[model samples]
Target: MKFLEENLLDHLQRPEFAELHSVLINHKFSKGSYICQPGMGSNQVFIVVSGRVRVYLGCEEKEFNLGILTKGDIYSTHTGTFVQALTDAVVLMTDVKTFRQRMVGDPEVTKAMVRVLGNILKTSFTIIDGLAFKDVNSRLVALLSNEARRHGMSLEDGSVQIQIDLSVEQIARLVGSTRQTVSMLLSDLVRAGLIERPERGKFLIPNLSALESVGGVTLS
Candidate 1:
C-alpha cells in the first residue's frame, strides 16, 4: 500500500480521520482512460501522483470539461464532474464510505477534509467568476496562457513547447465557452504572432514575456 506520508497526511492526526489510515486502494491508468463515469461517482477520492486528468460533467450522454488535475493534486468532490485520465497517470483511490468513517475515526482524515473543502470552495468561486466576468475569448486566452505559463518548456529559439494536444473545442469546454469563440481567440493569438502551431492541435508559445504580460503575470 502506498502511504501518504507527506504534509497532507498530517490531517490524519485529527480526531475526525485518525482511523482512516488503512484500507485504501492505489492504481494507475494510461492516457485516454476513464476513471469514473460522469454523475456516477461513488464517494471515492483520488490523489494524483503523476500526469494529468480531466474532470467533466454530463447529462443525457453529453459531458463537458470541469477541470484538469495535474500532478500532486487530489479530486474527491463529485459535484457532477467525472474524472477522466488526460495522460498516463497514477492515483490513490478511497471511497466516500471510507471517507465518512475515517473523518470521525482518523485525525488525519479530518484535517485533510478541511483542506480539501477549502480548495473546493476556492475553485468553485473561481469558476463562478470566470463564467460571470469574462467573455469567451478572454476566458480561453486566460486558460491557455495560464496552462502554458505553468506547463510550458522553453525551447532554444524563444518558443515554449506545451505538451497538451487540445483542439479548439477542448479548450472551449475548458473555459466553459464555445468552439467558435475559442477559434476566434486562437486566430487572434496567431495573428498577433504570439503562438505558433507547428502541428494541428499543438500550440507553441513563441514569446513568453509578451504572453505573460497579457496573462497578467508581470515579467519581473
Candidate 2:
C-alpha cells in the first residue's frame, strides 16, 4: 500500500544512496515463515521487495495485527512485533548500524525514515482507537475503506473495485475481531448494496462514498 512517505529506494539512482543499496542483502522467506519474533533482539532494517508480511503482536492464544507490509514497504526489526510472511517473499535488509550510518550522510534517507516512522505511529493510534471506541462492524468497515483507498481501482461507473486477496480469517485478525463476525459483516455489506463479491478475494463498491459513510470513522 502507498503511504505518504517517499520510499527509501526512490533515491537508489543517486550516488549518495549507492552505499546503502550496496549493503542490502537479499533474503527469501517462505509463506508462513516468521521473519522476526518478539524478543528476538534483531537489529536489521528490512525493505520488502516482493510478497506480503503481517506485522502483529501478542501470543499464540491471541494476537492483534498492526498492519500488512507489501512490496516497497520498509520496516525495522527493533520493534517487538512479530513479522510473518503471508506469502513467499523476498526482502532486502541491512544491519541497523549500517542503515543509521548511511542516513547520517543522506538527508533524503533521513526524511524517508522519519516519514515511515510517522506512518507507523499513525497506524498504531488508529488501531488503538478502533479497539477502545469502535465496535466490530465499524472496525471492519474502516479496514475495508482503508484498503479500498489504498489498493482500489476506479471504474467507469464511479464504482471502486478492490482486489484484496485476504481471507475472512485474515480480515478478522486485521480488525481484531472473530472470523464469524467478519463473515457476517461481509454478508451484511453485500446485502446492503455497499459491496459486491464478484469473485473470491475481490470486492466491488457500488458507491465509494456511501461505503465510507457506513464506517463512521475518518480514514487516514
What stretches of model 2 exceed 4 Å from their correct place? none
Compute the lDDT of residue 58 as modeled in candidate 1: 55
Off by over 4 Å in 1: 1-22, 58-66, 99-117, 154-160, 212-220
User: What is the alpha-carbon lDDT for the whole of candidate 1?
Assistant: 0.63
TM-score, one value per model = 0.68, 0.88
Q: What tens digits encode model 2's per-residue C-alpha lDDT throughout 1-220?
A: 4443344556665776787788889999998898899889889998888887877777555566666777777888888888898789999999999878766767766666667677667778888898899999998888778767876788999998876667888778777888998999999999999999999778999897898788896855
* Overall local distance difference test of candidate 2: 0.80
Worst 10 residues of 2 by lDDT: 1-10
- In candidate 1, what are the lDDT values of residues 108-192, reduced to their tens digit? 4456545555644654565567679866665665666655665567788878877665666766776776789778878887889
- In candidate 2, position 53 carries an lDDT of 84
TM-score of 2: 0.88
